[model samples]
Every structure is written in C-alpha cells, then in structure tokens.
Target: MEGLRHAREELRPRRREGGPREDRHRRRTRHRQPRRPSGKRLHRLRRARGRERCGGPEVTATIAYDRPVSNFIDKLSATGHVTHKSYKKTSVTLHHNGGRLSHQGVLNVWKTRPASAHFDVDASGAVAQYVKVNEYAWAVGDTVGNQRTISIEMANETLAPAWQVSEPTWKNSARLAGWLFAKVIGERPSTGNLFYHHHWSSTACAGPHMDTLYDKVLAAAQEAYDHFKASHPVRVSNTEPFPGASFFHTGRKSPIIAAMHHRLVAKGCDLYQSHANADVWGPGDVKSYAAWQTKLGYDGAAANGTPGETSWDKLQVPNV
Candidate 1:
C-alpha cells in the first residue's frame, strides 16, 4: 500500500505540466489583438477625415484660424465660431483711401497693428485677401451694418488732398464687389446691391474718386454679373406684368417688357419659340408670361394674367 501511494504522489505533479502551455497560448492571443488609438494621434485622424469630407483643407489650416482676436471675450464673440448662430452676409460694401497707406504698405501696417479686412485693393489694382468670406472682420463699426456687410478696404490716403484711387484699383474693387454681390444677393452689380461704406457709415470711405468713377465701377460690376449669369443661368417665369396695365400694346416699346425679355434670356428661357425681341412686346410673349404667372398661383384668365405687384414680387425683377 505505501509503495502505491508514493508512485501516485509523484505522478500528480507531472499531470499539472500542461498549465504553462495553456497560459502561453492565452498570452499570444491577447498580443495579436488590435489596439485603439488615443490622444493626439486620434485627433489627427479625425481632422484628416473632416478635410476629406469638406473637399478642402481643414478649417484650422485655412483663413478661419488666422484671424486675430484681442481677448478671450473677443474670440468668443467672433463670427463663424458656431454653426447655428453664424452670420449670413447679405451685401458687399466698398471703401477706399481710409487706411492712409498704399496697398503694398498695408500688409506691413497689418503685421504691426493686426488690422483685418475682407480684401485690400492696391494702387496698381492688385487684390489681397486678408479674411475668409464665411467670417466677419472688424472693418465696419455699426453693429447692425457690420453683421450684414462685408467690407473691402482700398489702399488710399483718402484724407490726403492728392490721393485718388487709380483705374486698376477701381476695376479690381468693382470686380470683387460684383462677385460677392452675385454670390450673396443673387443679383448682378447693375442691380445695385453693391454699396459704398459711406452709405452705411457717416465717413467717406471710397472717397470723392468713387463719385466720379461710379459709372465705370458699375460697368465692371456688370461684366462680372454677366459672367456669373452665363455660367449659372437661373430659370425665371414672367406671369407678372407692370402694375396698372392691360395688354401691352406691341406698338410702344415698353421698358418693363424689355427688362422682362432680357431677364428671361439671361435665365436661359427658350425665347426662340416666341420670336419675341427686346424692341417689341407682342402676343407671342403671353405664353411665357402665363407660364410664369401660373407658377406664381395666378389663374390663366386675362384679368389675372396682367403683371401686377405680386407677379413682380415673385419674379424679383429689378426696377419694374
């Protein structure tokens, strides 16, 4: 009996030899599993994903982050910081000769003082973008006006008696202004959504030079608008006619009809079928007008077919 007990005890320790191998197998399986990324590495991955989705560099690398803020409160108050409460710019306001420095010198001045403007027009008519379109800068003062306006400062010493905005400066400013107006207001520069800083504030910004070259700036603006219209023509209806009017007599060349025809053509409306020209208002134009009116909830009756304030309002035709 003692010999059998001794042999059994010796065999018991050898039987437990498989425990080490089982533990080693578990350790290998744990090591092979993937690890989760954390900290700065994870942040970088998330930012790259965002850049891919937005079709451009992430906001932090763009003009959105380069804007200057004086304090924590100023940073908190900056526009475009929050998506929900973001400011929607509606108009482009022009300024000239206020900075008392040439366009080339403006950058140096900005570097020292940290002033911000949406755009700066140089004496030679070059344009410099200091801020992004989606954010607001401290260019304009009136709180209400600033919220709705995008300011473009032109390099000129307007206070100086000899200062005059050069032709290149005027042309560039007009072009930029027109582009912003078309993008925001859905209207061309000729439609007059572009305004001077003086219009919004008591100070003369674009200066006296703007007064003389106003027509030229407007013409350049019109060119920009034409380009926009050609690239992105919008469809328009013309059921509405000028108020206090019956059937437009084809004999008299009505300005209202002319304006309507021009707008329709700009919008890519098929005018070849009607054979309506700008010089004459004719019965053939009625179908196109009626279609627009019907879209605007006016019945096809002649009484309702006549263009009125409601129709004009719906078409958004300027100066009807």
Candidate 2:
C-alpha cells in the first residue's frame, strides 16, 4: 500500500516554486477580446445564416399537379402551406422576398413556413412556381386577398436596404403579369387588376425600388398584355350568318345585336353610357358600330353606324 501511494504521488503534477494556487488550485483564465471575423469569414457566416433562414437547400421531392402554364422553369409545390380550396382569381398581387433570396431559397422557405406565393421570379428572370394558381396561397396577409389574388414573389438582385430586382427579372415579371392579365383575368392590364402587396398588407413588400418604378412596370405590363392579345386573338366561332343590313335598323331587338355590342366593346369601340348593352339597337350601338367601321378603314357613308357584311364577318360575333 505504501509503495502504491508513493507511485500515485509521483504521478501527480508537482507544485511550482511560486506556491500561489500552483499546488492544487485551478488557474484563472485572463479575459481577452474576441477577434472580429475577416471579410471572407463574414461573407461565409452571412451565407450560412441565410441558408438557415430560408430553410436550408432546395428540396427534390414535389407533389403531383397540373402544369397549366408553360412559362415557368420548374415547380416546387408548397402543398403544405397552401389551401386546397379553389378560388376565382380576380387580380394579381406582387411581392418581393425582402432579401436576396434565390428561386430555390424561396421554395425552401415555403416548405417550412405557413406562407407561400403562387410564383417566384429569381434574379435571372427564371420562374419557379409554388402554389397552384387555382388554389389559395397564404399570402397578402388577408384571407379574401389570398382567395382573390394570384400572388407572385420576386427575388432581389441587390440586397436590402435597396432590394432591387435585376432588369431581366423586371421584364420577365412584366411579361408574366401581362400573360396573366390576358389569359387568367381576361381583362386588360391595369392598376385595378395588377396590385402590389402593400395594397392589401401593412408591410412594405415589393420593396422601395419596385415602389419607385411601379408606374414604369405597369406600363411595360400593359404593353406586353396588348402584344399577347394581338398575337393570340380569341377565336370566337360565328354561329349565326350575317343578317341583312336592314336588320341593324332602329327598333331591332335580337340576341345578335347584344352579341355584336359585346364584340364591339371587346374591340375597344364601346359607346354605351348610363345603361347596359341590350339586344335592342339604339344610338349607342350606332355610334359604337361607326367607331368599329372607322377602325376597319371605312370613311364617310361607308363608316356609318350600319353594320356591313364585311365588318360583321370580321367582328366574329358569337351566338347567345
């Protein structure tokens, strides 16, 4: 036992000559300032934090859904976040990610968060769809707004305090908005139908850069919508042949007149005021038809309110 004790004592660390807590007490550590991260280290740290904030990298799995539109590059279904109930989309609500989020980043975020947008446009103008257009995306901060709107989330090319999208992103967004206005809403692109996220929510979404360029973007969208309409005109089949010119005379009451009125209004020749378009012909119909005739290069008497067979055929009025 003594020999064992001696061996253990020899294994113990020897006390120094100072005798100030050197025999058995633990040494106290001196406090020193931490070194700041270098530029590259800071960048890496920011990137790592961003990934965490956006729910890490992109997910490969997705749910089965119809690909209604062909413009998008791919789809990452936010099925967990969206409402399965279908909605009648009346307008489009635009939003910005408020950070430098990529297409996959936006999808990744939606996977974990309870919120989602129907579409996300990246910095390079590539589009990624999340929630289906017919369903409700938990965006816009309001239930009615979500039910009525097709929400679009845009990625920032420049990071916040600026949060500006790239030129290609803006152009592609405008193009997408135009297509939606024409095909989805079946109406012209206007401020009434194309709305910002701030319109419904209390937050300043869409960012400052987009807010400044709202009018410019709206104008571009209008132009693109016009182009889309011109390129893809509605092919309404004529179920009824052109009635005689006398059929367009005053006191005429027929479904054909109402159909013609609708067609004329669609062609941007609306002259109705104070009353709805009816089957009975009236001064409004005359004026509207005259405007249509003028648009068809008719002049003088030829451009009179009377509907000519050539103009009537071109109008492509549908049967009631």
Best by TM-score: 2
User: Judged by lDDT, which candidate is best?
Assistant: 2
Q: After superposing candidate 2, which stretches have Cα over 4 Å from the reference?
A: 1-79, 233-320
Off by over 4 Å in 1: 1-34, 38-85, 97-104, 111-115, 157-159, 190-192, 232-320
- What local lDDT score does residue 203 receive in model 1, on the 0 to 100 scale? 74
Candidate 1 residue-wise lDDT, 1-320, digit = tens: 99999989987855445688986887789868578799999999999999899896633221211111112222222433322223777777777746545544655555555345667765434455655555656556676666676777776623555356655467767777776766655666653457787777787667777777778878888887677656654343333323334325445344456767666555454333654466466654555666567666667474243556566566654442
For 255-290, candidate 2 gives per-residue lDDT tens digits of 668888889899999888734647889999999999
* Clash count, one per candidate: 4, 0
lDDT score for residue 307 of model 1: 58
What TM-score does model 1 achieve against the real structure? Answer: 0.48
- Which residue pairs collide, candidate 2? none
Estimate every model's Cα lDDT from 0 to 1.
Answer: 0.59, 0.75
Q: What is the C-alpha RMSD of each candidate to the true structure, in Å?
A: 17.8, 23.3
Clashing pairs in 1: 97-156, 239-293, 240-307, 241-307
Error of 2 at 56 (Å): 27
* Per-residue lDDT value at 300 in model 2: 99
